[model samples]
Target chain A: MATARAADEAPAPAAPAFDVKNAFRNICGFCHEDYGRKQGKGPQLMDNPNSDDYLFNRIRNGKPGRMAAFGGAFTDDQIREIVVFIRKLKPNENP
Target chain B: MKRHSRKAITTASVAVLAGLAFGAQANEGILKRSANDWPSYHGDYKSWHYSDLNQINAGNVGKLTEAWSHVASRATRGLQGFPLAVDGVLYYSSPYNQVYALDGATGQMLWTYKQKLNEDLVAKQTHSPYNRGIAVGFGNVYMGTLDGKLVAIDAKTGKLNWETKLVNSEKLTVGFTGAPLLVKDKIIIGSQGGEWPWRGPIFGVDAKSGKEAWKFFVVGGNEGTASDRRDTWGGDSWKTGGGGGWMPGSYDADTDTVWWGTGNPAPLYDWAGDEWMTKGPRPGINLYTSSVILLNPDTGELKGYHQVLPHDAWDYDPASGELMLIEQGGKKYVVHPTKAGFVFVFDRTGKPVNVYKGVDNINFVQDIKPDGTLVGRRDMKEGKHGNLCPAIAGGYSWNSGAYSPKTGLLYKVGFEWCMDLEVVKTTPILEPMAQLNIGANFTFQPPKDGPARGHIRARDPVSGKVKWEMKFKVPPHGGLMATGGNLLFIPEADGWFSAVDAATGKVLWRHNNGQGHNGGTITYMAKGKQYVATVTGFGSLVGDAYGELWGEPWVSMPKDAGVLKVFALK
Candidate 1:
């Protein structure tokens, strides 16, 4: 009975971690092209991933106050990319 | 006092400033409106966002590179400031009310005055984290703090001359957003946060002593309307009313009358709750929420006014723009551009003369009737969710629109792209960024559409016509300005600051500044050399969406993250 149960159980791989660079390139729309500034809309997410949740909440919300909201505007997966991108720019990792 | 000579009132970031012609003494503000010295917001209150030096005009502006960039450090200070230059010194109020004086030619820090802040300093700044900036008057520069204090410092030495607690928000608290307005020995300033049961008033403070000279409250705005508010607000419209004068006002020294526009009634969306100030004799007009209200600059007495948005339900604030008075055809007409999309022209008598819709993609006001009665749009309904045009941020938000006296046109960059908006009723009490209150603000969803997706248009003041417009990759990132030459500088939501032919509306040149812009553009002559400057700190409501929508319109320049970039052609 144990051998039969083991045969019935198939394995599933875990979800991958959000890639900071890929997320950034995805948003920046420029892969391997580091345009330090000049990227409009929202400035570079560089090192901002470590910001407190509320600031990120406000930033991701689209509208800060009386502006507009983006709760449903972006996918959660994409947002995870934003979080990862901010993390990748850790000074220790880069230098 | 000829028209062209008055053009020398130089400044950066136009703030609905105004002026009047005086004797030909060349005594405008302290200096000739140089192309480098941003003497006052809107130059010198003549509200001419125009500069005198044509050094960086259409011809050679191509060589206009970022001459100097003061990128802010996250821990040191944020760049939520408008740099005010007097002669060769540049003064700016940075994050935490830290004042920095920089050299005009080079963005070199000369002196720094950091206002010590405790942990509680973060609490007072719920509205805007940073001060709009400081004001330069006489020989001193003035600034207000987040912890509730206004300090005056020697403009040259950066030494504290006097520090006064104007309104201790610690009790009955409110924030300061209206940049200080200095008129002679007095400075006129008002506070924001009118929505929060906070008492709103515009005061005349002694410029030197920091003593309060006069205070004007909006609850009882019109002295002539009798003491019994019940008579003025026939229905229960006067109670819990929230008309506040939040921005710096304009003045006519000759007439001794200072004019300011007040904001919308409180519990913003609930007209019924705040009916005491809304319903009755002053009912629709509401005794000046959206009007050009005049008072004796010294007395603070109600002189005269004309309502622009009677019961501004659409959240279309006429109070956002400064009462910029423009003179043409020997007639003194005040051109007060409203966030609601109308550039309402009124004679000095406070009578509406003509109203023009500066933007076409607006659904805020129904129509500016022949009699100046805003019928309001017919399809505009309450308690529903749908796409609203021109957004509550407005067709032309708080960004200052400059007028080129040389061309007789109001050079403006209007935020035309709209949002799908839904209004709901709410209580007066609102938490900072909560999920509870939905009344005062409408739900907006920015649309996918034409080049007019948040655009910038040039208009004729007298005719109320769109001369030519440059659609932004997204909404206009900032405000606009015109110079002595045929040049109009406008910013795009995607981070491109474009210079257009002020005459033909042609895109003369465009350059990227790394991020989208929301700050206004200003010009001045520094060391006899003219320079044009603007601030970019995108990522607010408009920024996040447009950046997401248009992909990318600018290249990232972290060195200038939310900085003041001054440009001059080589």
Candidate 2:
């Protein structure tokens, strides 16, 4: 029993919550409407539900001649996190 | 019997005269002349964008109607190029390196040349792959691509004659967005990579063979080259100094020199940006960039240059505007509407004579020296967010203005917006492929006083006085096309192409065709009928980049199907 003394270890820190508001204010909101209340260069994203597949492809591959693809800029996890934040966006929400 | 004979003979004579007139106008188009055909960008060597065709005059412009429209299948972004008209066939270039030759009279698709550009490669470009237009010379159509290739296709067959790689995209990310200027036997093309970590260049190629003739480096201090002005730059800053030749240059046959406006210097905050705990590397006035450079058209030799913005950080590009050669007080002067919102008049020897504040909100420079040297603000170098007028888009943009030899006035569209400026220390954000390395960031801020607006200004080139200005709700995006009938044709970003009174700035006629009209206006005649044509759509790097401030209902408006709108008087 003495040979099997338990060693104290710190559990992996929980991943920091994604700052969708900060990301929206700094990057996405520059081109799209802030909080998705109005249309900017890109279409309004509020009150609209897009499939995960459609959102993933559009964000990764981008619609040529219209939008810039973020697949290369953002990682798979980061993009997924962004999509999650986008899904939680409510119409008329003042971000 | 006598009356019938007289009527028949008179009718025969009138028909014969009409046939002769048609032949003359047709020849003008075939020969690439300016008066009757828009053979080149800016309409002619004078860069006037004016036509002597009076058929669609002020009295008859109200009757102008859409004759026909051809919807292009690809490269359907905003059409920014001036379609070249020659021998009844109209040729134009679109985004993604697509070329189309359409029937000038019927809008029928004659032939289309679609370049197999790698979308992955094009996505790496710093700017949109929109080609301003094609150059017609040596019986071939010439165009520069976003992938950095100079292509020549047979005008009649649309066959690829030759394709030459002008700039290596891997070494330095660059693209061609302006039309190539066919000067004499040489096809002069300007490269667009100002926003990248690049050493810009202006290349002269043999028109017939597509062989490189000469190259003029826009940024100075290249190793083993005489253009080294190392003293002007601190450390090795000259290696990546940004001074691109983005827009098509104007040539002066009188001086046998090519006059091109150079873009802003690299590290937009080189002189500022203390928070990054960094000082500007290129400390002295960065030569060549943000200036009007004069060079030998054949050999690419630097003759002279005049810096319009010394130590500039607001991304003010002087070369995006038209360079007008005018005679004031029996002397010749080059009138350039600078991005700083000033109409700068320089003598033929590259000496600044006068600077006039064309817009009301330009507060960056308090004064301009007699030789066109700029006086910078004291706070600009302090690295603090300060309110700067005319924004980064400035009072005017590359939507080149027109100078009417008839009116002695220059008609240009102006923006009345400003931006915020400051310096930050952090890793530079690089776009895909490191195509853009802008060392700092700024935001387009609307003026605190009022909503942003645009103006259609008629300025006298001699006195630098505004004769009249027509304000609008939306900022205009296209250039001006003046006709001999005292009409100035311009398009708005809000989807209306209107014809204004060239003399008084009166809105004579406007049509809401439901498309953001940002393409260059061009006019040509076929069979004695005058037609004014421009492309309409809603995608522009400038328009979209500043969408938060200038776009609203504009971005929400239903866009047109990228139609080649050709109007003719009924």
Candidate 3:
């Protein structure tokens, strides 16, 4: 009962300081490497012509037989954060 | 130094392991009797990569032309495997786990087997999903998937027979990159995520039910004989000591032994902050991490093991080397080319017979103990060690070396660059989904003496002495294929598929295919003529490992250009 009260009373956990650069370098960069400038296992995620909804759905649900689903692993907010980060990725000649 | 006695046999148990009753005679005969059939991944069980076909000789190789070409539908990454030609169809796998059966004579597709791996499965893969190739036996083509499934499909119909999850990818970040070896009735596959803190094992899945037949962990665990292995890890580091067997194992039908090489310890650099004097992330000679492990293919029982580099600080993974069976002076030896720049020769019983530097200026290993354990450079711990030659890819990596009985030489493609090692304080176990969990990182910087280069050497397997060597601008990426016609065929990173004289390492013929070759090459007889097949398009992480000091060819490769090229006498 006390723990429940504390949970109800405490402030919500703050969103993480999502280091987009480090996050890309660590995760998506392994395949859609060079800040998503070049294609790898997946197509280039930057300067993509797809909509936000398409990118978000694809990132979350993942295409069958091709990409993996990250919806279960990442929170909705986290996915949004990643999508926003990806949207800002600029295209460079050298990946 | 321990030995496992042979299993006491019973009629039922023998049948289960050997599959005497359910023997696929046709596939067995192709592997055992035929020289023209590229049945197994290493061509045959011998892992020689040598073809006895001499229809296209060095004298006439200049007339060789592209017989045909096939482009994979979704080959976005580098192609890293050869096609397995059996009967009249050539079976090849793309990096996306799609297997295609093409007409051996013509480049027409017979059937395509595409195994869909979801993002969750693909995320857990330790390396690129580029399967080396599929193994064929029992009328089925067996492949280990990036999602940790041992998938068997009907070789003719391309229908899925059975799919077995070999590793718990959800629990451990490990998957299969090696091709499954169809031995007897068992589909044997090994793990590939040692970098993700995987405790290694070679799994034998029952060919019929897809059930695990037996499992032999490279690093022993808390079981009967494995209890002794606990002391080797500092603290609980043994729980996730990386020693994955990423490459396929060689089957010795003669001794019933399957020889496999194991990868590096978890965290490429094991020491942390002055802990070299006290407690390290991983201490003691990390047993079985960088070694050639011999096992009884029937029971998955350990026969013996010989560690190539003990307490490996450098990422000198023995797992990438192909286990070679070379006979010297009437005695047989299991030769291994390691990332530590040495080709190690050992007797069949796991006794180290000889070890010599396969490349030039290997100063990482300062001394070698009497028992073959290396005394590496002490300064390599917890700090920047300048100019470590044969860097992480070693003298060679997963690109297999070929041995020819006719020439009595081993043809190896090796890198001649050195890298600077930088170790920083890091967590012990590789975090579940981290990019690199090691204590150190490396960047390619040329030695003070010369520029970074690659070499293809024809060396004596036993003596480790180079007979004749040819240099390349960048490291050659594919496996070597030696033919009986005094010609050596190898694929290069610079988009050239060239042939050199086997006796003298002279470039005899060359073809510019406009894409680099980073996979294995195979030769087989189709109809009455002989043909050579190899996949092109480079983009191995080894290419990404170097810096600008090397060259653009070393790092910059165009994506989605993976194509299989076939050549024969025009």
TM-score of each model's chain B = 0.84, 0.90, 0.91
Query: For each candidate, C-alpha RMSD in Å?
Result: 14.6, 12.1, 8.6
For B62-115, candidate 1 gives per-residue lDDT tens digits of: 778777977554311124345677666666665556677788788888777776
Point out the worst 10-residue segment of candidate 2 chain A by lDDT. A1-10
Better TM-score candidate (1, 3): 3
lDDT tens per residue, model 1, A1-95: 00011112222222154343322322232211132122223344444434656534643564322222323323556555555555455432421
Candidate 3 structure quality by residue, lDDT tens digits, B158-236:
7676777777765565577788777776778888755665577789877656678887766643247632454555555
lDDT-better candidate, 1 vs 2:
2
lDDT of 2 by residue, B127-200 (tens): 66677877776656789888777877766666677777877764454677888887776888888856655667
Error of 2 at B350 (Å): 1.6
lDDT by residue (A1-95, candidate 3, tens digit) is: 00011111222222245544434443454445445664544567878999998988887776433454656545677778888988887754322
List where candidate 3 sits over 4 angstroms from the true fold. A1-95, B1-33, B123-126, B226-228, B273-278, B369-371, B428-435, B546-550, B553-556
TM (chain A), candidate 1: 0.37
Interface RMSD (Å), every candidate = 23.2, 15.5, 12.5
Sort order, lDDT high to low: 3, 2, 1
